[model samples]
Target: MYIGIPKEIKNHEYRVGLTPASAHELVAHGHKVFVETHAGEGIGFSDDDYRAAGVEVLATADEVFEKAEMIVKVKEPQAIERARLKPHHTLFTYLHLAPDAEQTHDLIKSGATCIAYETVTDTKGGLPLLAPMSAVAGRMSIQAGAHSLEKAKGGRAVLMGGVPGVEPAKVVVIGGGVVGENAAEMAVGMGAEVVILDRNLDVLRRLAKRFDNRLKTVYSTSKALADHVASADLVVGAVLLPGAAAPKLITRELISTMKKGAVIVDVAIDQGGCAETSKATTHAEPTYIVDGIVHYCVANMPGAVARTSTMALNNATLPYALALADKGTKKALEEDKHLLNGLNVCKGRITCEDVSVALDLPYVPAEDMIKEL
Candidate 1:
């Protein structure tokens, strides 16, 4: 099997799909790895490093895409990259297709087998591949929100961890999953008044125990959410619905009534955001004001910390990548039920039920598609 790694071309996105160590592991297993020139340069992995790991360095993304059987990437393929995809190619990456109709249509037209990292599952029903980046984005939410809360950034001149003479800012995290937990952890560590809201009682209970009363855990209700948002200095939108679009929990009307200079860090922006006013921003210009509320909705939050994000992502995705390379895509996915869940599109068919429903496309079960092969 020939595997390809392409340099990410998203705005300010520098995370590479495969680290040198990861490529070395695949090389050791007798798989040929091809990487675009300087793919890992942003993360301190030089071409020499890849060569030392026995990877072939291609000068252009076109060559890598042309020669490799499986294409590994950190982010979704941009328009040009998607155009390079062939029917024989297997794209293994974070394809957030539920929200982006253009990308979805392109992937379908490409007729390539697309496996989304965000949709992969574990035995315990957690998104193993998505968890690493989610944790990174969750922790960074507080850091970004804190910066956005500065007076110069159109936020209330409030410090997250207030001085002895001042009260700390109130932080409301609207979810109790990986993102919300990490966001609340950071906010509490910074001495902010942290509160987490979730509709799941089990999740809320677990979070309550995890935080040990350091933060408040409230059952998510219309009234409760409204009350929390009304007083929150910073709100972290961390909700998710797997491969579906994130629910708009914060409406425009509610946002209009929030504090004049409040900040909203929408970690769920990759899945179309949990706020009505949220739009994907880039690191170059990360915040914008709507109704006098500052919004930090960078779709690729983890890309800002590319080195750490690449290594952490490799830790989770390498095993699966090996499975696909060693056994072939159809055989590998047929063998592992969890990995099969990652199949979003295969052979021009939408294989993820949630994604199909979200996009109003025809649903084709991964098993059904694989069996036909």
Candidate 2:
């Protein structure tokens, strides 16, 4: 099998799909790995580093995409990269297709087998592949929100961890999953007044025990959410619905009622955001004011911490990637139901029920699709 690693081309994205160590592992398995020139340069992995690991360095992304059977990437393919995709290629990456109709349509037209890292599952029903980046984004949400809360950034000029003479800012996390848990942990560590809202009682209970009364855990309700949002100085939208679009829990009307100059860090922006006013922003210009509320909705929040994110992601993705390379996509996915869940598109057919429903496309079960292939 020939695997390719292309430099990420998203705005301010610096993470490479395969680290030098990861390439070495593939090389050890007797697989040929082609890395785009300087793909890992942003993260301190030089072309010599890749060569030491037995990877061939290609001069252009076009060559890597053209020669490799499988294209490994950190982010979704941009328009040009998508155009380069061929029917024989397998794209293994974080394809957030539920929210982006254009990308989904292009992918369908490409006729390539696309496996989304975000949709892969574990035996315990957690998104194993998406966890690392989610954790990174969750922790960074507080950091970004704190910066956005400065007066110069159109915020209330409130400090997250207030001084002895002043009260701390109130932080409301809208979910109790990985993102919400990490966000709450960071906010509480920073001495903020933190409240977590979730509909799942078990999740809320677990969080309450984890925080040990340091933060408040409220049963999520319309009234409860409204009350929390009204008092919150920073609201972190951490809700998710797997491969589906994130529910708009915080509406435009809700934002209008928020405190003047409040900040909202939408960690769920990659899945179309949990707030009505949220739009994907880039690190170049990460915030914008909406109804007097500041929104930090950078879609690739983990990209800002590329080195850490790349290594962490490689830890999660390497095993599955090897499986695909070793056994081939159809055989590997057919053997592992969890990996099969990652299959969004195969042979131009949408195989993920969530993505199909979200995009109003026809659905084909991964099991059924693979058998036909």
Candidate 3:
């Protein structure tokens, strides 16, 4: 099988989908790997490194996209790349199609086998491919929020970890999943008064146990979420609904009641945000003031730390890429039920239920589509 790795073209997104080590492994398995020139450069891997690993380098994205049977990518295809997609071509990436009607329509019309990394489930019902980036984004959420809270950044003129005799900033993290957990960990390490909210009692109990009472675990109800947000110096929106739009837990009215110059890092911005005021921002201009509250809603939080993000993402995604390369998408997905869950769109049909429901489209069973293929 011929596999392609294209340089990410998303605004300020510098992560590459594959690394030299990944190319080496695929080449060892008798699969041809075509990497777009400079794809791994931002991730600190040179073209020579890819060549050393026995992977061929292409000069343009068009060459890689046009030739490869399967394209392994870091992000969803942007408009131009989506136009380049061909029928039956396999696109394996983080396609957050639930909220983007245009992207959904484009993927549906492309007639491609689109497997979203974010939708892939493990045996334990965790998003395997999405977890690594989620972890990165979660950690970065605090870092970004902290910066946004600085006096120079129009924040409440406070530090996350205060000086001697001064109280640290209060951090409220919504959700206790991978994103919220990592956010709480970062905030706690920074000496902030950290509180995490989640509906799952078991998850909250586990977090309480793990944190040794250093952190507060609140049972997330509408009232609880509102109360925490009202007093939070920094609120991290980490909620997710796997392949669906993130729920608007923080309404505009709720944000209006927050402290003046409070910062909100909506990590769920990629899948639409958990805040009513959240709009996708870029790293260049990642924050905006709304109702005296600062909203930091960068869609690609990991992109700010591209090298670390690319390597971490490659580590998590390489195994699945190798599986697809070694066995083909059909054989690998058909054989592994977990991988089949990743199938968002296949042969021009919506195969993921959440995505279909979110977009108000028809949901077709992946097994049924596999049979047709």
- The residue-by-residue lDDT of candidate 2 on 1-373, one tens digit each, is 9999999999999999999999999999999999999899998999999999999999999999999999999999999999999989999999999999999999989999999999999999999999999999999999999999999999999999999999999999999999999999999999999999999999999998989999999999999999999999999999999999999999999999999999999999999999999999999999999888999999999999999999999999999999999999889998999999999998889999999999899998888888765
User: What is the per-residue lDDT of model 3 for residues 1-373, given as tens digits with 9 covering 90 to 100?
Assistant: 9999999998888888888997899999999999999998876899999999999999999999988999998888999999989886889999999889899889989999999999888999899899989999999999999999998888998899999999999999999999999999999999999999999999999999999999999999999999999999999999999989999999999998999999999999989999999999998899999988999999988998998988888888889998988888889998999889899898788998988898899999999998765
Whole-model lDDT values for every prediction:
0.95, 0.95, 0.92
- After superposition, candidate 1 runs with Cα above 4 Å error: none
Candidates in order, TM-scores: namely: 0.99, 0.99, 0.98
CA deviation > 4 Å runs, candidate 3: none
Q: Where in model 2 is the C-alpha error above 4 Å? A: none
Q: Which should have the higher TM-score, number 1 or number 3? A: 1
Worst 10 residues of 3 by lDDT: 364-373
For candidate 3, the per-residue lDDT at 53 reads 96
Task: Please state every model's RMSD to the true fold in angstroms.
Answer: 0.7, 0.7, 0.9
